[model samples]
Target: MLASMPGLRPDQEGPSLAEQMTALPVATLVVRPDNSIADANVRAETLLNMARSAIIGSDVARTIRIAEAGARFDIWHSNKAVAAYDIKVHAGRTAEMELDLMIAPIVDHDGWRVVSLHAQSQARKIGHRGSSGGARSAMGAAAILAHEIKNPLSGIRGAAQLLESSHNGQDSALTQLICNEVDRIAALIDRMQDFTTDRTLECQPGNIYPLIDRAAGIAAAGFARNVRITKRYDPSLPSANINDDALVQVMINLLKNAAEALEHVPKPRIRVETAFRHGVSVMVGDGKGSAVLPIEILVIDNGPGVPEHILDHLFNPFITAKRDGQGLGLALVDKLVRDMNGFVQYSRDREAGESCFRILLPMGMA
Candidate 1:
């Protein structure tokens, strides 16, 4: 228990290293001399919304955002362990969390790090890190903006229909385009509303293979027509803890992104694979205990990988690589998965190799 407040004590006995880290409520991370993540405990994974394997080599700065100026400045500079109170820290892509942060240099390993994060108060449990204090203001603006835009859009569509009925010139074509674009904008707002609304998840333990099959089938028939989609599944894998609709939508979003990226590749192939991983668990949702997330779903594509610059913020809202993208696909996927207490991350098996999106979800039972 955290009453003992586990640290990076090498000689600490009894519980295994992984078990000790998993048992502690504190978020602990070890950064190597080169500033990459060498290791991270379960609480850190829970804070960062990634599996320990996926997080192992990611750049430390990109993963954890230090919001304030002085909170971490003196600590990192002095090469000494420093504890600071009530400082804001943002985990990857989610909102910023204010944590009691501790950073210490590992003396034996040439400037390695042992960073720990703890919540100072019961009122400040870490979940829901939205905009940098501007979320409520943004929500109000979105509501008003959605209302104002929809009313005018309805009028424009009605006017365009009238013009299309009466006019037969090329201007009538312009009117049709206007109507179609207006409808498109309306549909986009509906999706945006999905992001803004705080809806409860409809979660359950259900078979995931069928969901993956349906999503992949849709992609192959429609957007992914040029590529071949393959599956490598463990038929005995347990049911996943999730909402079927949300999980299907996540699968479809991932498949569509992969298919779109592979549009021009000659032998563009997409792989959908599932397996059961043992001893993989993460702490999610206020850290009552660790949840065993053994079900693994991987979406591997044989296209040019995701760009390096955007990889760090891949799950953040409005971050996209496409010219005409609003960048909500991966963001929504992240939110939906978190609602189900699942984890998804961008990873590559080897350095500078094929990119893969790995999703680790909890099985029906612990």
Candidate 2:
């Protein structure tokens, strides 16, 4: 009865699973209850460099050879409901690429089956070149304007100081206001200068655990003292190539934002997590050809989360969620990370009631 079902096979009345899965962007493959290749989408056929007719009805293990170079049919045929394995596939006679294969069991009228397989390439990585260019232009213009205003500001501050010394009562108060305003402007300019300056990254392979711990310690003792801090580090994580000082700056900026976001919430908390991520890559270009990105650092905070209105422009210059914020902290951070060939992105986690920021950096090439 199942073999005669319309959706069971191409000879039947209904559309096959291969037809439905071919519409998806990712490659997909369907296996029969006996661990045989029942069907494959167009993407999967292309990835395997084989024709659909030749692949269908064949053993799934016959087409895909895992990195271990052994028959993987038994793994999928096991009683396990789900399984995953990484493999490097020969794209052509000479080309090889890595891919992550996920196998999941499904039940249908025919019987129990496995539907799995997706081709992941490391060559296709994305970067933030466009946004980085915009940040550089804006930061440069602000630096120029800040520099032009610096000299006149000093004169005004000196005049205000002199006036305050010679005046009394309300007159002195007005002079003090002028001095205070000038000082604030000067400090703002200093922050802008830091953003504009071009400096070569002093990269060295260093474990990130200690760096994160140091940042948490500083936050716990300072503005974030009232907030509880949590650390989750993957001990198996390898050393990351980064400038210690710059990385520390990045951590502090994120911590400060997290602290401020949780200020009014009950039982405020912040979490820092580090681990090796696979199949996560950034595209450096908008075109078909883009490099694959690797490695990620995640910082999460339990707060109200980023406001929906300005969420898209969080990395833009002069964007701040706080009332008294100058809004240059994250902009500067974006610039510095971009300089090191990395990208920063943020997302609001409604389920977790927090805002998540992830930093992606390329691992050292072998």
Candidate 3:
């Protein structure tokens, strides 16, 4: 719609084509094959803080740079339109913009792209060229800090226990508080050490339906008591090559997360689905080899959605939206999934009004 205006031409009198684009909320740009901007909307002008005369016939890459995760400029090189999802792109020289980018080819024009930039609030802090080293640094710091603090924490806990047994009246409560707080800190440290552990994962081919049922039964009795859960299981699905217990941990954590998100909602529903989608693979080893991953499981919830600020880095440790949250649950899930040679990602169906977390696992061996 941004690219084509019905029955409207440049020579028309009364509020010409450019005026129509000015009224659009999204920043629209028509780009030449050489990456020069042929046209832009008023919103684009405002976003870039430039006049039409300055924006038109200029290089869009100089105005804004686009990156898709680690693969920068994948959208521009590709030939299809990626829709309904938000993308994080490095804008200007040092700024970032997360927006809904839709690229559509012109009707009759060859080698031209119509790029629409619809702004959103979430800024993906990861996936620039040099950002991973910083993340690894943070993880290393967490591991070292947890190990160093545990020694002092052990002494404090022992002293608290001694004082609590000897003290009476209100002093007893204070010592008990110290002991409880010490235990909590120790538990948090134990969780953090999981990230630093180089433990080898042992996975076997196993059916996931019974595992899902087991987790669902547990959540129904406990964390998800207030939520309504439904399952759409593909009974004929093959065995997923994952550790069954590890997969259960992933499921339980996901369910707890969904339950927490739905706490304030009047009607809370979580849908667990499994399907066998064929022919899904990514190129590996010089782009000639394809690794197939067809076993799909999706956890969908009718909650509001992931917050915009943390959506991009939801799986990154220490990035969380919940109060009193250490932000390691989803990160652990990602690590576990990757350890099993699988992939997990978070997405939202804006039109259907649901948030989806999908896991793709191999059947046996890729």
Candidate with top lDDT is: 3
lDDT for each candidate structure? 0.72, 0.68, 0.73
**Model 3 per-residue lDDT tens digits across residues 1-366:** 344455867665455566776777778998888878999888887776788788888787667664443431244554444332334556544357556556677767776888877665222222111123333554697789887999999999998888777765448878888989999999988888777865668988888888888999999999999999999988788888989888998899899989988989899999999998654443223222334568998999988888898867777788889997888888777777766666677888889999888887878654
Q: Lowest-lDDT window of 10 residues in candidate 1?
A: 122-131
Q: Report how far residue 222 has shifted in candidate 1, in Å.
A: 0.5
Q: After superposition, how far is residue 137 of candidate 1 from its true place, in Å?
A: 9.2
Cα error, residue 292 of model 1, in Å, equals 2.3
Model 3's number of clashes is 1
Candidate 2 wrong stretches, greater than 4 Å: 1-16, 19-131, 168-170, 283-294, 364-366
Cα lDDT tens digits, model 2, 108-173, are 435346455555421121112334655777668778978799889999999888777776554887
Q: Pairs clashing in candidate 2?
A: 124-291, 124-292, 125-282, 125-283, 125-291, 125-292, 126-282, 126-283, 126-284, 127-283
A best-first ranking of the candidates according to their TM-score comes to 2, 3, 1
What are the models' TM-scores?
Answer: 0.63, 0.65, 0.64
Please give the TM-score that candidate 3 achieves against the real structure. 0.64
